[model samples]
Target: MQQTVPPPLRPYIIHPYLRRTHTMIKKRIEDDILIVTLENGRDNSITAEFYHELKDIIQEANSKPSPKGIIFTGEGRFFSSGFNLSMFLSFKTPREIADFFSKTEEPVLLDLFMCSKPVIAALNGHTVAGGLILAMACDYRLATPNPKAKYGMSEIKIGLPLAIAQGEIVRFGVADDRNYRDLVYFGKMMDVNEARENRMVDEVVEESELIPRAKQLVSLWIDNPGRAFTPIKRLLRGPLADRIQKGIDELDWEDSLKCFFYDDVRKTLEFVQASLNK
Candidate 1:
């Protein structure tokens, strides 16, 4: 006699307010994992709405029970191209730009860095600029071995400086300053093997295996009791976390805003907009 097989598990939408839409960041729960997928166009570029929705989702994930870990990934070919340059170009003044970062971007990234549960980045493809920063904030990173996919910080190339909190996160995340300088100062885009070597990614696998591998990693962490894991993680990450918090607290809005109006930056923004128009 044949035995009955159990039905496969299905994911449920976890965010109460999410309306399934092409551009909305999506949240789903499968077993003990919470999956957050970036879905804001081809590049999955960060927008104001994206930041707000993501922050809400992260908060919700932390408040809920049973999910031992979170997995962050992008919808398609690009993990994320970075901050929304188009949105920045729309800002009328440097103060507005400063306010956007202080209120939205910085806080969201910091939240990820300090999340109570372990977070994993499942990089589906190319990740650049602020996208790289976001991934680095996660506890672990796994990427698809797509030769075409590039990874690096391109802020300097784009005429932007890394904010204080962002700089601290990089310093904490990357094991070597030389690699960090190569990514941030030189703006070099590296392939998967190079990224893994430089400690940007923990592992690289086929595209189809990315999510499964991320789940496997999360399961390994989740097997530990939360009471044991949470405190240890906090202790291990505490010093850097404190520095990040201090930097954010002391962030100089006026000095930070000055870069937004720099002639070179303005030209870069114009060039980006022009390219997008084409």
Candidate 2:
């Protein structure tokens, strides 16, 4: 006999805020889990603006009376193609980049680590670089079995070190130091099987089943019903989180770092894109 998988539950209402921002990142409650959808037709880049909105939404989720969980997923086909290269190239100074990242993103990462709520990631498609880091922050990651789905800490491929905070999260998420090094250092995109084998993802299911499985997984935490889940998670994750936070505080001129300067990355990416187009 074979098993059947359930379909994803579509949120009744998808709210969009702040028309100024190109991306429409929104949060809604489904049962006990807060579903935060990263929806911008533009590759779902994580700009400082996105983090500001995320902080506001997460704070709201925390304020709710019921036990809480989070489900992070992309709006369309792409989970995220990673940082928007065009955005990366627009930085005028490293200090600006550093300041933007440290001030906006660090707090969000800390919030995810410290939040009493359990988070589940629905990897609907390819997840790259910082995007993958966002998914890894969650307590559970459910990926699609599609061969096209790739996930990795690919910052090194563009001459940047993965953010200290992101690296630390991946480290703790995988639970094995060696596998973490291979995945982070190689900066290579891994298929679903490779991701599952390396412990980058908790489980892989059909694309249509990703969200429901995520909800089911979070339900277990909601059912367990206590601080034990988040408490133990934070406890085990405390040291690494502290280390990353300290590193972020110490970073200088991070925004201006040539590693992510658009020109170089663009040139490199053009060849890759051309090859893919071939």
Candidate 1: pairs in clash: none
Compare the candidates by TM-score and give the number of the best one: 1
Q: What are the per-model C-alpha RMSD values against the true structure?
A: 8.0, 8.3
Q: What's model 2's overall lDDT?
A: 0.69
Candidate 1, residues 53-122: lDDT per residue as tens digits? 6677667656655577899999989888887787777777766667766766677777777676778999
| Alpha carbon deviation, residue 152, candidate 1 (Å) | 0.7
Where in model 1 is the C-alpha error above 4 Å? 1-23
lDDT score for residue 107 of model 1: 70
How many clashes (backbone atoms < 3 Å, residues ≥3 apart in a chain or on different chains) does model 1 have? Answer: 0
lDDT of 2 at 266: 59
Clashing pairs in 2: 89-262, 94-255, 94-256, 97-255, 98-255
Per-residue accuracy of model 2 over 1-278 as CA lDDT, tens digit each: 22111122112111122113554577777876778888866467665566666666556556554536788899776787665554545556665556556665665776675565677889988888878888888778898888977888877776666666667788888859999988877888899888888888889888878778888877776566444565566577767767877787687646435465566665775554444334
